[model samples]
Target: MPSALVFFTELSDAPSKAQRELLTLAASIGEPTVAVASEVPEAAVTQLGAYGVNKLLVAPANESSFLDHSLSALEAAVKESAAQVVVVANDNFSREVAARIAVRVDGSIVTDAIDISADLVVTKDELAGSYSAQAQASGGVLFVTLKPNSIEDTPQAQAVSVSVEELAVSAATAPSVRIMATEEKVASDRPKLTEARVVVAGGRGVNGDFSAVEALADALGGAVGASRAATDAGWISHDAQIGQTGVTVSPQLFISAGISGAIQQKAGMQTSKCIIAINKDVDAPVFEIADFGIVGDLDKVLPQAAEEIRRRQA
Candidate 1:
């Protein structure tokens, strides 16, 4: 069997859902090995073994930026393992690293792949989920960036023992840039926007208040999202924006409140398994694609829905 390499910029105490998915997919393809820039926490190492990762490669701590270190580690791992298949998370930074790796290794790179078969055929959705496409690298190493939430992580029946390896990051691979300072973001209990199974989004209809949208999202234990209009209006941070120009999400459930359901926004989240739209306008475009629709003011509708959900839970 070929050797498959999975690369991550950081490893938390426990492997994240996306990380587990990547490991599982790599195991399915071949002998699964993981390369991370930071030291792997003991919990993460054990969980990686559960996902069938037998080899763990750690890059030496360096003064370079996280991205630079990640690039050096991944490049070294690919060469050391002669990995025929490399998997990465589909994010801006990872995509940049994947692109560089492709250029350096003379490999073909594919992004946003939802599935990869044992034979290395990659499957992905195209044209806003209106079409599905399968792609195969003609030859050489195949580098793929998988979309989050696209695959389910299933642990091995029994855990495999992990062998740790230290990677030597050459000076040439390290960039001249260095980090100056860093500040931690305000912590929130909500799940990440991309990885959340449920999302509640607000738009212009919320006027300037997100209390109702947030209440519903909190009640459902989901992440909060906002349309471009709301973000542009300073109602929420750009990080919460969900649309073509922002984050793309494919959650199991997506609720849109006060959003117009423009094509740009649809392009980001149309792949969601279920969508519910709430708006006062009877002919809103969001209603066109929503599995369920409510033609009522979101201010009143959202709070009521939230209360009902909380009540049922209790």
Candidate 2:
């Protein structure tokens, strides 16, 4: 059978949902092996092994270690495992790491692949999720970064003896970029905007009242998002903004309230499995692409939707 490799972030007691998605994708493609540049927890090791990881390569870790510093260790793991395909999450960190690895391995690269077949063909969005195209590896090894929600992260643990090795990193392999400081974001119980299965976004129609957006998001167990206009108007943080200049998302469901659905905004979330737009303007651009469009007052529409969702769950 072909072998697949996955890279993971070293965070928490277990792999994050994004990392688990990589693991699941790897297992589906071939024999799965995982590489991490941090101290591996026994629980994490056990969990990954149970999820069909045949080997786990742990790179030496430091307080400020970054992905660039781990490239040498990762190169060694890829060579040793002889993996044909490598998988990672669709994020900036992974993209940088993949770019470096592609050069080192003389490999073909693809990012934000929405689907990958067992034959190694890749399918991803193009023209800002307006079209989908198929691609194949032309050289070296196959490397792919997957968008969140492209695969389910359910673990398929089996009783297997997974070989765990600690990779050595020589000082010569130090990264070019040195981190002077690190600032962590404030922790939140809510799902990450990019990774959430459902996202509820607000725009100028909210008139600075994000209460409806927050409540609807809370009811749906999703993350809150915002349009560039909303963020520029200071109704929400810029990080929550969804547009060409902000984070791109591919959630199972996206609810847009008051957003105009300009090309910039559509670039960020046009790939969502289901799109519902609520705008008072009958000819709002957002309604053109929405799977369901409602012409009404958003404050009233959102509250009612949230109530019904909660009542159904209850």
Candidate 3:
């Protein structure tokens, strides 16, 4: 089997759903090695083994917000493993790191990849999900940034003990900028907007209130999202915004409540497998692409839907 490297910057107690998906994909393609920017917790090591990762490479930790440490770690892992295929999370920072590594190693890179074959062919969506394209790099090394929820994470039949190795980062990789201070946002029980399999979003029609949207999202065990209008009106944080200028999500199901369904909003979630739009306007554009739509007041419609969902689950 060919050698593969997977990069994960966050050092959580265990692998996140997105990271598990990356590992699962890597295992399918080749012998998988995981690279992290910080020390791996015991729980994480155990979980990595469950995904068939025998090797865990740790990079020297640094305080730079520029992710220099992460880049150094990936660079060192590439050299140590000489992996033919490299997989990473599809995020802005990861893309930048992958790009730089591609240049350093003279490799080829593909972003937003949805699938990768054993032979290194990448399948991806393009032109706002209009085109499904397959691409292969013409080089010894192939780096790909995979989209979240693109693959399922299945554990190996048997778990193996993991071996940890620390990589030596070169001083030349130091960052030019340093973070002076940071503030952590309040944590939520809901899943991340970008990673959730189901998303419930609201817009200006909510009239600066998200209780109805939150109720439906919470009832379904999904994440809460917001349109640009809702965020700009101080109804929700910008982090919850979903649009061309905000975060993009391709979840299994998407619910749009009290939103006008403009083109900008579709640019972010047009790839969702199923879309349910709720609006009072029967002529709303969102209904054009929706698999299911309700022409009613979201305030009343959402709460009733949530109650029914809860009742069924109960």
Instruction: Return the top candidate by lDDT.
Output: 1
The C-alpha TM-scores of every prediction are: 0.96, 0.95, 0.96
Please identify model 1 stretches exceeding 4 Å from their true place: none
Q: What tens-digit string does per-residue lDDT give for candidate 2 at 186-293?
A: 988889999999999999999999999999999999999999999999989999999899999989999999998999999999999999999999999999899999
* Count of backbone clashes, every candidate in sequence: 0, 1, 0
lDDT per prediction? Answer: 0.90, 0.86, 0.89
lDDT measured at residue 206 in model 1 versus the true structure, 0 to 100:
98
lDDT of 1 by residue, 236-274 (tens): 999999989999999889999999999999999999889
Candidate 2: give its CA RMSD in angstroms: 1.6
Name the lDDT value of residue 65 in candidate 3. Answer: 41
All-Cα superposition RMSD per candidate: 1.4, 1.6, 1.4
Model 1: per-residue Cα lDDT at residue 136: 93
Model 1: per-residue Cα lDDT at residue 91: 86
**Candidate 3, superposed: residue stretches over 4 Å from native:** 64-66
